[model samples]
Target: MNKKEKSLLAAVVVGVGVAVFKYFTDRPKKQSIKSLFYLNDFSSISKNFSKEEIEREILKIYKEEINLDDKFKAILFLTMIEGIESLEKYNQMAQETLEEYVKQSSKKFLRINKKKKTGRNIYRENFYDLIEATCEPSSLKADIKLGIEECLNGNFKKGQDIFLSSTNSDKNTFVSLVICYFSDELEKLDKSAHKRHVKNALKDDKFLFLKSYIMDKNNMYKEQIDLLNSIEPQNELQENLRLQHLLINLIKTSDIENKNVNLVNEMIESFLSKKHETTNTVLNIIGISIEWSIINENIDFVKKISDMYLQGDIDTYVDCRLYVFTYLIVNFVEKLSEKNKQNFNFMHLNTDKVEILRKGIENNETYYKLYVYLGGETKDISVYKKALDICITKNEFINIMRILLVTETQNKILQSNK
Candidate 1:
């Protein structure tokens, strides 16, 4: 071969080597970014990941120059991470990012609409409405803020008047109106006017649950039942509505032989049978059923169902485990009450059962009621102290104190009478 040809041949070989090296070196980075995209895509269904793991993955991805669409997606995924270890600092950051993105996007949308104004843009209308209707405090007016505080303080009449007087009758105003009506503030207002407001607001599915609640209150049982039945629950809030509907029906049918009991039983079985049912769903069903049984004064049924839940045949989801334990404690107290016993013997429970109750008691808010029941039944002041220590909310602590006082007074009266 000629020397020039040899030099060209070596150059070709070197170029091929560099290309191969680049492909191999960059492949993993590309794959890592691709994997992050997949994680973001399937985040809604990705239940196996811990919150810390998700946070780490999100932080790693955030360092990259992700496209706008994927950035929004990552923000959404971050929102779904449960029990965020940083007390939701990450969630707050995500929310700020989302708000800024929405602001920029809104400006862009307006520019587009102005340039192409053939007619009103429906997308712009809906998107802007959504941004305005979000529960962010920054999106609300001062009057709306005052109205919310008034409603919370039980000044529903004042709150409702303020909410209705606002020129901005967005979704939150409608919600406040419903709250006022439910609180009976509208009794002084014109019934026709209240009905009109509700009718107009009923277009949003967000109000459907409240509408059903109104129907249930007004003895429009069939209408409420139909409304609840029409709803296909896609998330935990909707599932709660479904459970509430069932509970209302159970309450309406006062007959001891009501067929709704069988329906509830079937629902419980169906939910337990489903491997995909969320912990929140399972807990809702169980809690509702327990409340139903209590309403019916069916203590025996409570015992039966509580025992079934505590037997561990069904895998107890972590969030629901405390609830199950609370139910077990309630059942124990009720059984003791039935036998006219003042205190329960811990020796009766197996070691594992005792451990379960102890672990449950360690979870303050989740097992708050259990502490109340235990304190009342055993006349244990220490139990009340434990409950009060973990109680953060003023209303809950006040309620617990009232319970303790009443129980103590009852005990004194009983001892004196004896």
Candidate 2:
């Protein structure tokens, strides 16, 4: 009741209020499920930490985040991470998460809007950066894994069937199917069927990235850039794809000394470059850039890049393997032909490297063409016939012509000997 007591009570009240406010304001915010959307975050972490450390952090997050949305995101994250062979040890956990995901996702809680939106599209909105449109697709991770396994085992028809069967149900599956069709591992896909699937895949707006990849394959650099520019990238993969194709377009269209090439290189290096080992993914981009450099006859740039990143164990990378083959074949062919030998430096053919590359590659039809070419050079009638058979089977009209030329020359030599 005294003035002193009243003042003390007032001070105590203010102190309690201040303490409560500080507690609420300084407390951590609940982690958002959207954090899993940008895989670049995990990629950056993986670069710095061991896989066990990353898995511990991820598992801690999964355990702490009990909210359904965050839980589903964690499951999908596990699936995505498990897809990388580095985290193959997480296989058991991935299956458990996947089963739980299927159980929960089968409920009618998630609403899917099939009608196209004006920007970014629904898959980005609902799945947070994942390219899948529905929960059903995520559940098909096992099938996708099997298809990839089949492809790796060189069962092209079985792999193609596994992928094609799931295409009607999921955009992710359809994209995988398209990628396998073009990939060297599974080269036996019927051309018409692949084209049809590509046509259908393009009907979906999210497939613009896939379309750009196809455009790049066809040498439509300008068109590919224009198409990529139309939409914003939803995730790290799309963003990387955009940057890569843009760099490729610059290389294909611009002179080697163009400043725009440097600009794109800086942008790409910001994301892709490492002080030590570069990733297989980065090697693929670099490999394609080298290929375009070869096409442009910028041998200086090619040599510089080859020396820089082409060190270490590159044999496992398909694009880099092809780059080596292309470099060797072009060098040999140019020197052998009088008309084309002017611009190219007379680089000695390293037959040892060629044999090593050939052994490293699997049963790829594209690289097999090199064998056909070598067989043609032998000029034996039996070799020529075998080469012709391959050229016809694979629809290599240029190789077919070369084989016929060898046949004609052999015939003339035989008649003269007789």
TM-score of 2: 0.39
Steric clash count of candidate 2: 0
Q: Model 1 misses residue 121 by how many Å?
A: 40
Local distance difference test, per candidate?
Answer: 0.52, 0.49
lDDT of 2 by residue, 145-217 (tens): 5764454333445766677677453356355435533343344456675565555555545545556666676
Best candidate, TM-score-wise? 1
Q: Tens digit of lDDT per residue, candidate 1, span 1-418?
A: 9999999999999999999999988785433433735443343224445566666776666556355445655655556455666647766766665555544433321111112112222222222232233234465568866775564443556766777677755444355335434344333456675565555555545546555655665666777777788888665556655675666575676465477777766665555453333344345456666666666555555555545554452224254344444545455555555463333332223434434444445442334565665665567777776665544223445556555544443343334324
Clashes (backbone N, CA, C under 3 Å), per candidate, total 0, 0
Give the best candidate by lDDT.
Answer: 1
